[model samples]
Target: MMYKADHKDSFPEKPGLAGLKVLADQNYLSDPAVFRNPADAKTTLAGELKALAPNNVSYVYFGALPDVPVAPAKMPLAFERPDLRLNGNLCVLFGDGHVESLTVPVEVDDCEELVSYLHTQKKYSEKELKALSERAHLLDGELGL
Candidate 1:
């Protein structure tokens, strides 16, 4: 939030999760350990504290976040990458600054889960919805759903 406050409510825009470097580069966060999940042993602590590599990071930064969204609580910011998720659940960081564990469900779930939940439950504007879907597709592919 501090970074957003300073940077006109925009996040570090980069491909996939690499944008997280903005946090360290901009000094919002200095430690790479902060990005890792303690439960994930596969991901090692970065030697140089950079999110540039997927193996060293635990989460995927969804790129479709709006500036000062009206329903921040309903938006998905970032989530634990599929391999990092335990027991078929991923921890999601919402726009409201809350974290939740989401059950893994493929489109076969009828609801198609994940992105479907965002579209139906959140009701973001057309532009925001398009952005969210684009980013969510990348994440869904990683999750294999």
Candidate 2:
């Protein structure tokens, strides 16, 4: 709202996780706790959004989802805990305001598999990959992926 008002009714051009801070930076959003990943009992909001959680955050913006040709409902706006976190269940929010928790198909279940899958689409920093790897666990248990 406030952000779009000032920026030609638009959010950041390529809003990533840190882009959420763009709102905070403008005082549009003040609490970084809203962005904290519940799965990660470690880092704080400052370390997560401000420092750009190389490890993992609660939600990630799919800023690159095609806009012109694709419909809003088809576009992925953001997702929660896709990095083998939260029991492989991802809460995806589409551009049309629909939210769904999708489980990663059994085939791609571990950090290595998810990392490889991401490799096909985008490049993640080695630090980020290592972080995901360190938390990799396929079972449904506490802090177990």
Candidate 3:
């Protein structure tokens, strides 16, 4: 609301999860409570909030634009409830402000593809991506990707 009111009904400049903390610090949001996911009991924003650490944030932003001009139905704004095995689900927030929960099959190929995409986008360094891929299987239950 604060962002849209100031930016002519536009969203924030970046669509990353970290941006939420930025907004909170800037007073656009009352606090970082909005960043907390219900399923993640371990995460909190009471103390100093750091986007890089993310502590317990369950959702991942999909590189949304500042103005958010993409098609509402197709664009995935964020997702959560990630698991690698045993009925893990992906909850997606569409561009239209609608939430949908879908079962996304987590396979080795899918994980590899996502790692490649993240590397191409420079979300992490080559070394980090390599390490993530190597430990992807071990992190199945704990990984948020």
TM-score of each: 0.73, 0.57, 0.55
Model 3 segments more than 4 A misplaced:
41-46, 50-52, 66-69, 81-86, 108-145
For candidate 3, lDDT tens digit of each residue in 11-41?
5544445556556667765544666665566
- Estimate candidate 1's alpha-carbon lDDT, on a 0 to 1 scale: 0.65
Clash counts for the predictions, in order: 1, 0, 0
Q: Per-residue error at 72 for model 1, in Å?
A: 1.4
Worst 10 residues of 3 by lDDT: 135-144
In terms of lDDT, the best-performing candidate is 1
lDDT of 1 at 18: 54
Q: Taking the tens digit of each residue's C-alpha lDDT, what string does model 1 give over 1-145?
A: 7776797776665535556776777888788887788889878888776534777777777643545354668777677775557776777777567998877653323112465665665687787766666666765564344
What's the CA RMSD of model 3 in angstroms? 8.5
Give the winner by lDDT: 2 or 3.
2
Top candidate, metric TM-score: 1
Candidate 2 colliding pairs? none
